[model samples]
Target: MLFSGGKLDNQALLTNQAQKMADVPLMITFDGEWGLSMRLRGTPVFPKTWY
Candidate 1:
């Protein structure tokens, strides 16, 4: 599973790596509280937390 590490943010790099591991399914895990844009750019961001 992909986590909060800044390594996987590169789409081109991820795509290349994923192609190499075609046998395995890739899963991206994001913290719902922060939203997917927490690390990467050009994504939706929630203003506040539910809790």
Candidate 2:
């Protein structure tokens, strides 16, 4: 999984990128341990697991 420009808040952009890889079997994945909001801006940040 790739996070362009450090962060990706646009789902459509991700979809568009995935669509571009139609021929290849892509497994789009992300680090959930940190949570999506942790990487995305303008969203409520989830508490860290250690917290």
Candidate 3:
């Protein structure tokens, strides 16, 4: 599970590292809430509360 500012960006980094170590399968998973943003890119804020 990787929760960071950049999801796909982070995945690329991890993939590179994994390739260096050895060829292996890497599964990246994220919470559904990842698509929601309260004030992303300076837009109107819609506060979200998880759980």
Which regions of candidate 3 are displaced past 4 Å?
1-6, 23-51
Per-residue CA lDDT of candidate 2, range 1-51, in tens? 555323454855876778797887666665555777765655567778775
Go through the candidates in order and give each one's C-alpha lDDT. Answer: 0.61, 0.63, 0.50
Model 1 scores what on Cα lDDT?
0.61
Candidate 2 TM-score versus the reference? 0.48
Instruction: Write one digit per residue (lDDT tens) for candidate 1, span 9-46.
Output: 47547766876888876665555447666765656666
lDDT of 3 by residue, 1-51 (tens): 343344455556776787677656656454436352421232334656677
Q: Between prediction 1 and prediction 3, which has the larger lDDT? A: 1
Q: How many backbone clashes does candidate 1 have?
A: 0
Q: What TM-scores do the predictions have?
A: 0.45, 0.48, 0.33
lDDT of 3 at 19: 61
Worst 10 residues of 2 by lDDT: 3-12
The clash tally of candidate 2 reads 0
